[model samples]
Target: MTLTQDQRSLLTAIAQPWIDTSEWPLWANVQHQFDMRGQDADAIFHSLPRVGNEVSFASGYGYAAPMRAPIDPGHMVRLTVAGVSKLPRMRIAVGEPFMHTLRHMIDLYTRRPILVDEVPKTILRSGELTAALPKLDPWFVKVLPDLLSYEPAINTGGGAHLSDGSWEREVTRSVMQFRGMHTVEEYIEKTCEIVTKNAAQTAPFTIEEEQPMPTEPERAPYVDLALLDDLQKAAANTHWKVHKLIALCQGLNDAYKAGNPYVCAAMIRAVMDHIPPVFGHKDFKVVANQHTFMTQRTDKIHALKLVDFKDISDDGMHRQIGSSVPVLTMDNIPQPIRLNAMLQELLTILRKEAAIAP
Candidate 1:
């Protein structure tokens, strides 16, 4: 079967690392194996034109040549197009001993759940069935051996020693073994003690026997209207630039309410840009242009030791902003939520400054 993009990616990730660190003796052994088979080992495995210091995997069918170079170390070996074609045969000849290491390395890199169906055809064809079997979920254990077996199907009729009834009994026994040693009741009883012990240990320190249900406080508005009103009044006596800052604050609130955090992040950066002048920095524009100034300002706000707000701001300014893709997505709700909190804290700081302005 033609490999899927994901399967190819996983295979490349597994192979490249192994080839890089493998000793010269391993390649030599592979060369020797191909030579014995009366094959031009170098032409198949190493005939791929080396562009620079790296060696390609010869056949461009499996992986991209330069982008995903198989061999990292500069070396000349017998790896050519024909040798590459015989890779599956070579792996099979090496058997489970070598494939075990490859399987383990693949498992380490691809931490996602692997299925029997997902095992690449190359792995299956490599005669490492036993090594590859355990990589699948335990449910496939009993059946895989039979499936991979080269033995002819037994004829149940014509006085065959292995009758249908005997085969059925064997299959039943194997299924039971696969399901595990304990029955449902036995397993539950065995595990229940540990569960009960853990629950008791983690029970609340002061549980009230008849406590009234606590009502949740009213949901606060994203923008604090009263605080904004106070700041507006306070800013009237200060510089006119604070009005632009206040407008940005309102935009930030609107972005949060609309669930568009990318816009909210832009607004936050805008607010930061406006902040330096308000704090009496003589060369606020010039200082703000420097990357270090932004980090220093973030650090100053973080040093306020506010309630985990620093963490939110730090994550926003550092991690989230640095990401190539937008941080606000269904899979990454926390990033946007954290940014919202950071924005609120920043607005609070600005509001406080406006309130105390001369």
Candidate 2:
């Protein structure tokens, strides 16, 4: 698929720095660019495979899993000029050929297309790749200007610039530096480290608040149990069901205070489960489970909107995993808090509808 104009712009912006420094652009480089532009790094990073389909050099590009040993760095694999259609067939560690070919391409100053037969058996070794650099340098230099002149019309309004003296000067400087480099291996390694460090330093951009999956929401002040002592005392003369609800509310409030949010969440579900049965609505009795009871009957019978009850129940249940469990996090204080507020509202409705004292 073809890249959109925005995608192309993003790709060019990301690739230019690496090209200018004569380095192979990695996924981290793309991530860094997105971070700088305040775009979603992860979304843009995943989109590369589609964007890469348009670029000849980007075939087979993918992230390499981190090495088993902690000291080794995780990097990306990409098809360079040397690996174009052959790297996938070769037996080597991921990212090896891509890195080696990138070093060779920059050192030799050319992406000389070669047949599979021409590819060396031991291309991973720096010494073997270095031997072929001189032969490729002339071709690399010849095509250098065209490669660096990427998206010339992007900034130059649709028309191409007839003469850009600054572009020529920059290319000349880069060529001179390329010639002055002594060891291809050292240059590649240094550049790789520099790029990795720079990429690491870039923080992922924060998505706008208007977007979904908001971390926090505007909340009402927490209603402490101590402040609700009057309500609890008032329930003494009320029906047994009302007394049971008051006790559940007390337990829910106590769970929150004790920092057992999972317990609080469970208490919320418990209250919902108990309250529906107290009404004895025909629809509530017909439902197979509490999930259906809360979602359907409670809304119909009490005019209480438990539209998000299923989601709340699911989130609460998942949060009840043991401390050792790593499947889901246990930090769900808001779930119970939200449910407590809903329960409070439900209690107020019951007090008025049932005409209970106080």
- The residue-by-residue lDDT of candidate 1 on 200-273, one tens digit each, is 44333566555545533222224443334334444445544345655676666666555665556556556555
What's the TM-score of each model vs. the native? 0.24, 0.26
Candidate 1: Cα lDDT at 258: 58
Q: Over all chains combined, what TM-score does candidate 1 have?
A: 0.24
Candidate of highest lDDT = 2
lDDT score, candidate 2: 0.38
Off by over 4 Å in 2: 1-234, 277-337, 353-358
lDDT of each: 0.36, 0.38
lDDT of 2 by residue, 44-115 (tens): 434543212222211212222111222111132122222221223221321233334444434443433456
Q: What's the lDDT for residue 159 in model 2?
A: 13
Per-residue lDDT, model 1, residue 95, is: 25
- RMSD (Cα, Å) for all candidates, in order, is 28.0, 27.5
